[model samples]
Target: MEEFIQEAYSGIFEKELVKEIAETAALIDFEEGDRLIEINDYIRSMPLLLNGAIKIMREDPDEGELLLYFLEKGDTCAMTLACCMGQTRSAIRAIAENKGSVVMIPVTKMEEWLGKYKSWRNYVFESYNKRLGEMLSAIDNLAFMHMDDRLLNYLKEKAKVNNTTVISSTHQEIAYALNTSRVVVSRLLKAFENDGKIKLNRNNIEIIAID
Candidate 1:
């Protein structure tokens, strides 16, 4: 785990600080579909993903939930940091998309690191910037793009994050992530199939091309 952190977070912090993190941080592993954070959960530690990916989602009381973005290797959850700093409950959910490991820093250590290490401060700021940009992109897709375009973009993003063009997701799962009905998702997927944009099978979608 120490070697893993040294490799994953190389150049992000100085050697001494890295050694401190390696010594103090708790290493944890997760399987796919495991919920790392849930709405209304109190977040006391900040997680830095070391391997695989996690999907962040925002819940709506009336509309189910929407996929906000993904946190891959070396990425940390900005919202988790914010919630911990403010001593507030988590408003978003983070689920492991595949088997992965993360190093969790306690809230107290996180605060101490920010004041003690310049690189730690920069990392927090950069995480905020990146997550904000992703949130804006998600908002643009929902507000400006049509459903077909949004669906295609969503699939493309999933493929990109998974490092494959073939996405192993069902129409219903896609609909839930996009905050739409399954029937609508199926209809649009069928349209994409007819247009040769994708090939659909049970519980999977193979993106043939994107125009």
Candidate 2:
């Protein structure tokens, strides 16, 4: 628990605060390909990814799992707020894309912790703002940008955040993120590969140029 707290926080709060919350939380371990949250399920708790990867996705008739995004070690999935706000159904499904661990805090307890600890409140505010920003960015791209610009921008931003040119997501996943078709994503990847800007290896695509 101390290790998880240490990895998650950078002195944003006193160690005591994190320890106190951790004492009341549960550590959930997941194997690869486990569903942590199903669509339309009531989200009773919030998960902070402690290790490995979790995928947040919306299922589609044609595309299957249209990935909304991922929750890495530092990420907290946003669906918990909907539940706490009295929503009965989850908008996305959270699945363990890889073997992982998450620290689960009851939504009620988390609210209590936030009210009692100013630092925790601040942390929650910051995370909320980050999510808001991402949503705004997505809306902006969808409304104003061309498909090529949006797709390239997405790839560049994703690569930047992951600190690598290689992205392990599939074409259909990127298409969903960019609000386009898989064929469009595939065509763009082919163009990039032909121009020596990226490489395609079946389901995974690599952006050869860092920019």
Candidate 3:
């Protein structure tokens, strides 16, 4: 865990604080399709992703699920902190996008670290800032972008975050993330393929071009 943190979060935290975090944090592994958190679930520990990616989704009771952003290596989940610190249940969901490990810090430790370590406080605020910016961008995309553009942007973001040109996902999965219908997603994807923007396979899409 320490070694992973050193590679991912080296300059963000002090050595001693990192050591303390390593001592208290539980090392947990998650597979590709695992749900790290669910709706209305109590957050006992806030996760700091050590490797791979976790997609954070916002679920509406009536509107269904929408992918908000991702918490990748060296990133923290601001929503988790908000829920845990407020003593409230989770309103969003977190799922592992790939197989990876996370360092879970207890809620008590989160509180203690706020006052005990300056680096911890800075980290938390930085997380809040970053997440808020991403949320704003999501809003912009939803409000102003067309479905094809939004879908393309989503695929590009996914590819960039995963560090791969090929994205393994189904039409239904893409539909769920974008809060649209599978048929609509499939149609747009086919159009993209015809336009030489992407190549569609059985369950994966290889991005050929973004522009």
Quote the positional error of residue 123 for candidate 1 in Å.
0.6
Query: In candidate 3, how many Å is residue 78 off?
Result: 0.5
Please say which candidate is ahead in lDDT: 2 or 3.
3
lDDT, residue 185, model 2: 88
Better of 1 and 2 by TM-score: 1
Task: Quote the lDDT for 48 in model 3.
Answer: 91
Model 2, range 1-211, lDDT digits (tens) per residue? Answer: 8667667665775787778757877898999779889887987877777787776776666655544566676678665665655747787878776777888878777778777888878877777777667667666766797787777777776675455777888887677666567999899778878988788887567888735
Candidate 2 colliding pairs: none
* lDDT string, candidate 1, 101-137, tens digits: 9999999999998899999999999999999999999
Q: Would you list the C-alpha lDDT of every candidate in the order shown? A: 0.91, 0.74, 0.91
Q: Model 3 over residues 1-211: C-alpha lDDT tens digits?
A: 7888778898888898889888999999999989999989999999998999999999877767899998889999988999989989998989999989999999999999999889999999999999999988889888999999899989988997789999999999999999999999999999999999999988799999897
For candidate 1, the TM-score is 0.96
TM-score of 3: 0.96
**TM-score computed on alpha carbons, candidate 2:** 0.81
Q: How many backbone clashes does candidate 2 have?
A: 0
Instruction: Report the Cα lDDT for residue 99, model 3.
Output: 88
Regions of candidate 2 where Cα sits further than 4 Å from its true position: 31-33, 58-68, 85-87, 157-164, 176-179
